[model samples]
Target: MGDLAGRWRELNRAYWDERVPVHLGTAFYGMEGFRARPDSLKGFETAEMGDVRGRSLIHLQCHFGRDTLSWAARGARVTGLDFSPPAIEAASRLATELGLHARFLTSDVYDAVAAVEGEIFDIVYASFGALNWLPDITRWASVVAELLAPGGCLYLAEFHPFSFVLDDETGSRVTHDYFDEGPEASGGPGTYADEAAVTEHNDTVEWRHSLATVVSAIAGAGLRIRFLHEHDHTFYLQRQSLECHDGDIYRHPEGAPRYPLTYSIRAEKA
Candidate 1:
């Protein structure tokens, strides 16, 4: 990593490192509840992935391995990789307490191939809010491609980039450019788990990868896209006007503007 990438990683690692405890204790992650009944995967994503029973799966940028272990609960031999040591530690500890057969390791997404000892997985799964933290979409795609075995697939479920351009207050107005403009230094106080929590190491950086950019990057990484599906709903609150129904799904208010709030991509290695 160069100076700019190194700087971004340094800032982001510290920010995420500090938030592991917050997320683990908060209702957002619900560690106790998770241990009782472990399944954090989205229904649609589960459907797209079909059955992962006994298949090897690798989760990139896995924060504390909730979703990773969720897959393990479904019988996938799972491996989780994250840049934060505290997160990896927490994930490993949780897996031990839960007695799930899973592996948690600390590694930047860009170096996942070597970090995993060149192991290949049958399914490469990445979920919501994972992409924006990274600086390069293309390299990320390459890592995913390398992590997959022949005929294996990469399943990516992410928040739609379109919704990101609009103002966070309301999804109606475009407040930012849709194209990449380098990393945005929008670092501030509080983690997403608890927005008002007082904390140190507030500085961080993130990049926005448009729909086209994300799709093109995966295609360029030599994976054949199986399907790309956009949804009208999301799992988290991305805008003030969004409504939470069933306690897990978020959508536009009954009469509010309707747009793709989340999207999923399935690509296979030839």
Candidate 2:
């Protein structure tokens, strides 16, 4: 397991390093608008996370730090972590360009405690397309608990595991296992940020973790679950078949049936 995890992390780092330039130029990440507005926070993040003013936040798997900077903009002292060096470089550049006092560290999330040198944060925020990359939610949860100061909380907004079972290609059929602990490997046609951007590097590995596993992991790490909220809409185009409604929000077309497209968990260390 240790050897597999190390190799998987290397593969994912290479994948994400190659992906950073693509994401930087893609309209999906909205780099231009982020420069103008400086707050790329989603409604659920604002609603569920409340004010981050004067808090210390560490964003695991931060993926170039747009969200991390967004939290900093709201007055949180922020640190962003990712395994990709190119991503950390880009994130640091963005922070300097925007005059935001944010730190970007390159480290696999499992090693986040050491990367931050045992520094405690008031909030540990992971969102959107994170968590699946981690093969062990139990260890991830422990890391989250380790990073937080006593009474500090974790806010995780992720795609629902149920949604992961559905075929994103068809958007109406079950294709993958919901409870599989795996090194689900695949080569991609293109990056999710820009489907048209041609890329030869597509090696990727992911795992499927159920909600029970996630919740139990957090609880076992000694964090009290504050709330769990599930949503029928996503802030990004998770599936090609999903329809865009208002803004960047996407959902199943009318009458196609609704399911929990996303879920949020707020857990606190006592």
Candidate 3:
């Protein structure tokens, strides 16, 4: 976690710090709706992670804790970890404002073990667009394994590796090599939350990981893969040619061949 990945984490911290306020005010996250309803957990995740009512759940790379608090509202003892101090601070504020019980820790995913001083959880939950920010999936899986109790599970929902290989603008071409082991530098004007919002630290580094690589890493970390599912739709608008459905979810337009846009995994420490 030193050298290049460390530098990339620093850059990412800046990028995420700048995004905190923008995301809080954006319609995508719907902070107002979250405040009123306080349930931001996706149906898919909720269904997969059944009965979190008394479970201890740790959310990795939890940006502003909306989803984490959502778990809190559902009766889970929740803890959130992020590298950006602004995000952690904002999450703390949001928890206090909503009167939800949750803890926010500022630490890189690689340092999460030390941040919590070896506390274990019943569930280690991470979601969409989280894995690309991590450079070493093997080490990340190790961290996930370390954080979970003996019967605990890691529940992950993420943008699919196949989709990550395709060009995001058109979704018709392969813009990047699918199997590249890289800390590829990506930067531009806008973010997924708000296409028009301006930011100074828009650039960030990310890595590509194929599905096999992901599965191998998790298995290497002593977790048993319970199930893997790929979906034809995404929770957000990922491509220009994609069509939005009733719930802000997006998929390939009608009459078009479907492609895997997102994937979820359930792995357990046996």
Candidate 4:
């Protein structure tokens, strides 16, 4: 477990440190909208986890804290955590600029839960594209369960496992095994920040967890599954032929009848 956490920390730090600066400059994060309105959270996140007013919320893998800050503006006592120092620093700065009350921590998820003492959140929130970076969903679920106050809720909206099976390099082709546990390796052409721009990084690593694995892990950690919802829309262009239909939601132009692009689930710790 120590080795796994260490390796994850190394990969996440490298990946996110590089991503933070790029993401800040992009419209994908709605930085300008956030600065102006202070309530500019991602549509997928806002639609799924509604009304956090006066609730204590903890956002895991909260890259640079746009969503966290947005939640704070909506009156949630927010704490955003990320393993990347640059992300935490940027989040803190953004919170300060917006005059939003939020705390940002730079620690691996496993360690951050342990480090933040005598505190439990009313809502534990995470969003799309977060879980893949984690190597161990069981441990991550345990940490979520631990940080959640009794009867508190856990909310997640993530890219569906079905979407991951498709080959993004080729248009709408099923190329990767859905249940495969082998490490999927890649050196970046650029991250999802700006798909049109090509930026090179010598290293990037990620692990994918299946839907069954994710649900079992959360349930195994003593959380009760409330509802699991699947959707055909994605927040980004997953492949060359993907078309954005309603501003943010994207899908294959040719339409694959079998797969969904995203899923959302809510669980309660009791």
What's model 1's overall lDDT? 0.90
The whole-model C-alpha lDDT of candidate 3 against the native structure comes to 0.90
- Angstrom error at residue 91, model 4: 0.5
Pitting candidate 2 against candidate 3, the one with the higher TM-score is 3
1-270 per-residue lDDT for model 2 (tens digits): 445555777777778888899999998888999998888877887888888899999999999999999999999999999999999999999999999999999998999999999899999999887888887999999999999999999999998889878887768898877767676775486787898888766777888788899999999999999999999998777787889998789998888878898999999988
lDDT of 3 by residue, 138-188 (tens): 999999999999999999999888886677777888887887867777756
The pairs that clash in candidate 1 are: none
Give all candidates' CA lDDT scores: 0.90, 0.88, 0.90, 0.81
RMSD in Å for all candidates: 1.8, 2.0, 2.0, 2.9
Score residue 81 of candidate 3 by CA lDDT: 97
All candidates' TM-scores? 0.96, 0.94, 0.95, 0.90
Q: Please, what are the lDDT tens digits per residue for candidate 1 over residues 1-270? A: 245455898889999999998888888777778889998888898998988999999999999999999999999999999999999999999899889999998999999999999999999999999999987899999999999999999999999988988887878888888885467776689877799888898987878889999999999999999999999999878888899998878989887769999999999999
Q: What is residue 247's positional error in candidate 4, in angstroms?
A: 2.4
